[model samples]
Target: MINSIKTPNRLVNEKSPYLLQHAYNPVDWWPWCEEAFAEARQENKPIFLSIGYSTCHWCHVMGRESFEDQGVAGILNRSFVSVKVDREERPDVDAVYMAICQALTGQGGWPLTLLLDTKKRPFYAATYLPKNSRYGMTGLTELLLKVSELWKTSRNRLLESGEQIVEAMREQDRTGYVQEPEKNLLYEAFSAFAHSYDSRFGGFGEAPKFPAAHNLLFLLRYAKEENPAASEMVLHTLDGMYRGGLFDHIGGGFSRYSSDEKWLVPHFEKTLYDNALLVMAYLDAYTQTKEPLYRHIVRKTLDYASRELTAPEGGFYCGQDADSDGEEGKYYLFIRQEILDILGENRGRRFCEWFGITEQGNFEGKNILNLVENANYREINPTMEHCCEKLLCYRARRTFLHKDDKCLTSWNALMITAYVKAYLILEENQYLDTAQKAERFLEEKLSRDDKLFVRWREGVSAGYGKLEDYAFVVWAELMLYQAIFDIRYLKKAVRFADTMCDRFFDDTEGGFYLYARDDERLILRPKETYDGAMPSGNSIAAYVLGKLFKITGEEKWRERSQKQLRYLAGSSGRYPAGHGFAMQAFMDALNPSQELIALSPEQEDLRKLRKLVAAKPNLTVVVKSPENGQELAELSPYTKEYPVTAGHPQFYLCSGNSCAASVDTLQALKW
Candidate 1:
């Protein structure tokens, strides 16, 4: 008989929710640390490393199937120094091993299973092994026994293979790739996206459509440069997603991705990054087309984040799980009778018809809400909002999915950027306030020695900041400065930019490394450039440097940004869809928007100019009172002689160290 008693492992004392979830497993799991490595070395055992986050469905499945099983646990405990790592906490570790896994197997994903030597170099890698051999794949128990035999017999070959893999990755990193950051790069990206564009269903590729939001941002910028097709693709995808089941009609945010091309079904997991990136995309769409639908989407997404994913301490949580009560999408799906019970017969039937809710449900015998069938639901029922509120209230009483409440610096930065952008476009003070609160929380809780850390939870912060953390937070600070015209924020941006250079920048090579040079645990420091689910550190760093150059008028900033762009140009041109943010950064570097400074103590023109800047979409406007001219002069020396004329605010269009004559009327302002 299987043992019913729970055995607490080393993970019981760990802080990560993912690790804590595995604390009661029969397998003696160790948290990723020097102590774990030391034990592996002392015992002369191979380290079995498992990397995943708390919200991952497959991670949970693997835990239940293999980790919780007594037989599988016995094999692992006897043969390997099993270690559990939360990918979100140590993304640097994940990046290095994931690259190795991809190299070994030509693909990689979580829950990442790797067999490493005592020195932490991976010798074997795979993802999600079952308890027993099934579906023509190796089982965890069998794999463990085989690995144990190999360790006893072929240990030399295994160590040699690990050494060779590490060397090859290092050699690959040393490759000096450079290309021109020209307008043609943007054209190439647009061409690639156009070729992959799904004319019928919207979005790129086949079934399993991911919301690669940076691609939309790139296309939106591309459309302005005389590419109407790009804009059409973006708008179609946005509208398709808005009407599809991938969007929570009851809740406010998007799931991680749609499982099918039609977006009728989703993976059911909601990540803070996806929602945050979607908000930016919708805001960009609203800016371009002034579409009310885009505006509504932005509002709904932000509201969902605020209501569900936000923490009590003003920081945002990581994500929500796909499964609830051991059933996938249970909390979200509804039966036809349930809709009738909640909304009554007349309205319920109409709601059912509109959302494609039938007795024969779209997913697992229950309807997942969607507007795919009745696209004109709003026209059919004007009281749709009230009905939705009623359904939402009822649904709230159900068992909610597990949420990952760890507030990450990089993820929080992305959300904060979205909030700042929302405030800029919508002119909502609450958005601005929310953005400021998150930034303040990050600053106070996740920072030490004037540097930001990776994860914060339950008043404890650990892990040094990665390159993305510094780059994204700098982007956030710049956005905050643009919205509020706070010199302190701008100065902080410059400070973090400097710190990023010191910590992550590759002096000999051009791109930034994913981890700090001083981080000793990493076998090989990976220099990542391709934008995956989120923008890469190199991409955001180049973007940040380009904006910093424009803001500070520093030649060093321009030179560094150009160098970084040159390093990224090859990937940006060759695989445009993969490097969407990098392409956008390249475009920004090529033709940066002119900086507009509205020098006035008067509130009216400054507000008008700020709104105009928002509407214009390409200009970065800075507003300051003439009374604080000395402060502006100290912060930015170029604005020293500029003054408010005749007690009325004046607008100066400045580009590349030259400012035009001050203009009073908005019509006289030059682009």
Candidate 2:
């Protein structure tokens, strides 16, 4: 119930889509800044901090139910200094505060609500709240009044509680000791995943299943080295996800996650990171098992990204919202009569049978359009493809879906790597071209003075880069170097890695911090290791460092990667399943890995050798031609002694610190 004549708030000046959505609310919302804290201190009032992203559905619900209400706004304006933050733009702030919420409430999610003192230490934390009390939940207005009363009457106690929480967090951060991970940690991680896996449904555990693509990537690596049975779980889960509503079969991208164990109903928000990581998972599946379905899924997912999420400047956008026209899932849902009218009688009936679009729908009396009911869903035909294309076009004209158009550096880097992987595995030059274009986009727009920024939108870049930005951009460069055997990309990766180490790496401790040393200081600096929907910054840092060490034979890279692995081992040993990406990095460190250096003048020979190495997941390859040999020698000094040949490529294969003699042909190498 906003005022009839609404005055714009401080959020009107911000660029975040989430912040802009609340620009006209009756509640005076201040974007996160020093001025908000100064106002809170001057007024001697607690701060109400709300953190969420634009595409989050519950955030929208909370906005309508509480933030727009006149009564709730009055209490928030009079008694507390209200602040709004888009978590995507300020993940450093979100990470530190989210740890507090999870510690206090035993769970955490978006529309994150916290009552904090002027010092910015949180005392009270919760998720979504209604304006009026309902369903046994506390009303936002009542909660505000109670907290205001406590601030006046029991001020000292509240301050002391906040101080204690901050101290406890500091203490927890100081508890870990650096130690090399045990050799059996990989087996332990595999056992954890195996125990929780749902044999029938394919995903792990119960309802509300996220894609968790990093876990599947780890399993693929583990299946290659140790247990072959690990692959069954990966294959089953991949097929199950594609067949269910979690994947948009017609539209060609995946939703956020499945709301049920059957994977039939999804949350319906499409994100760039989820699709990027899933593409890598599917590409690896295709490489290891040679499955056509996995390759098809990869192509479809990448095509979807190219069509929808990509910006005109070549960088990928953050995500698409779940709601359309003020209703969740409205853009995706369809009734039987609408489909029949759109496709006509025979083709419509066939499409309905194949995609589970029935008279009685599976969700809210409308079809979600899944292939869970079809036995031959993987077998594609021309008729099915044409009908889906027609339906997709019709759906686009029928509803308005909101897209978050901000380009995040870390997510765009992840997508770049996905495109590179697709190019390598599928031999599509367009994929490589797309990746190179995104790299140029990030370099031109997001990078300034050799340091990356967090986001860029509408020609304005803001916020300093975090660990994920540096780490993933380095990863993208490494992938680019591997795809094309370019010296410039390798040099660029090394330069960024040096900058990353200088800015975020903890020399005294082990892992990298979420934010840089010069970034704004929060209540407590956090170093995260858990791999959730996406891999953590430390995990990717460890992984790319390990790859660089293998490629360059640099002791500094090896030492840093080992230190990070030790830190991750200490943090993740108790619950190894939660740190999938960290374990994957550790596995790379522990396994018998090969480095194949191809010395030749012919580009065709180098290409064949690159494909051979790409097929083997554990092998790292570098190309040394007469033209680039001197440059390669400067980066990888070991390549200096290897002689370049004229007609065919001479391969120098090194496995676990031992080198075999150079071979003339692929048959002679006996790989």
Whole-model lDDT per candidate: 0.86, 0.90
| Model 2 lDDT tens row, 1-671 | 23548788998888898898898888889999999999999999999999999899999999998888888899999999999999999999888889999999998899999999999999999898888789998988888999999999999999999999999999999887777887678888899999989888788989899889999999988898889999999999998999999999888999999999989999999999999999999999999988788888998899899999999999999999999878888889989988889999888888898889989899999999888878897787679889889988998895667788999999999999999989998999999999999999999999987799999999999899999999999999999998888889999899899899999999877999999999999998889888867899999999999999999988899899889899888888877889998888888888788888877736666567658756876688888887888888889997888888666678778887788998876657756
Estimated TM-score for each candidate? 0.97, 0.98
Candidate 2: give its CA RMSD in angstroms: 1.6
Put down candidate 1 lDDT per residue, 1-671, tens digits, no spaces. Answer: 12338657888888899999999998899988899999999999999999999999899899899998889889999999999999999999989999999899998888999999988988889988888899999998888999899999999999998888889988987765788888877787788889989988899889889889988988988887648779999988887887898889887799988989988899999999999999999998999888777888898899999999888889999999999988889989999999998899999998888888999999979999998777573352447767888888998898988999999999999999999999989988999999999999988887766588999999899999999999999999999988778787888888889889888887765889898877655898878988878999999999989888777667788888888988888656667667889877877767656888777636666566667756654577766675566766765676776665547867788776577898876668877
Which candidate number has the best lDDT?
2
Q: Itemize residue pairs with steric clashes in candidate 2.
A: none
What would the TM-score be for candidate 1 when compared with the true structure?
A: 0.97
lDDT score of residue 670 within candidate 2: 54
Residue 408 in candidate 1, Cα distance off native in Å: 0.3
Clash list (residue pairs), candidate 1:
none
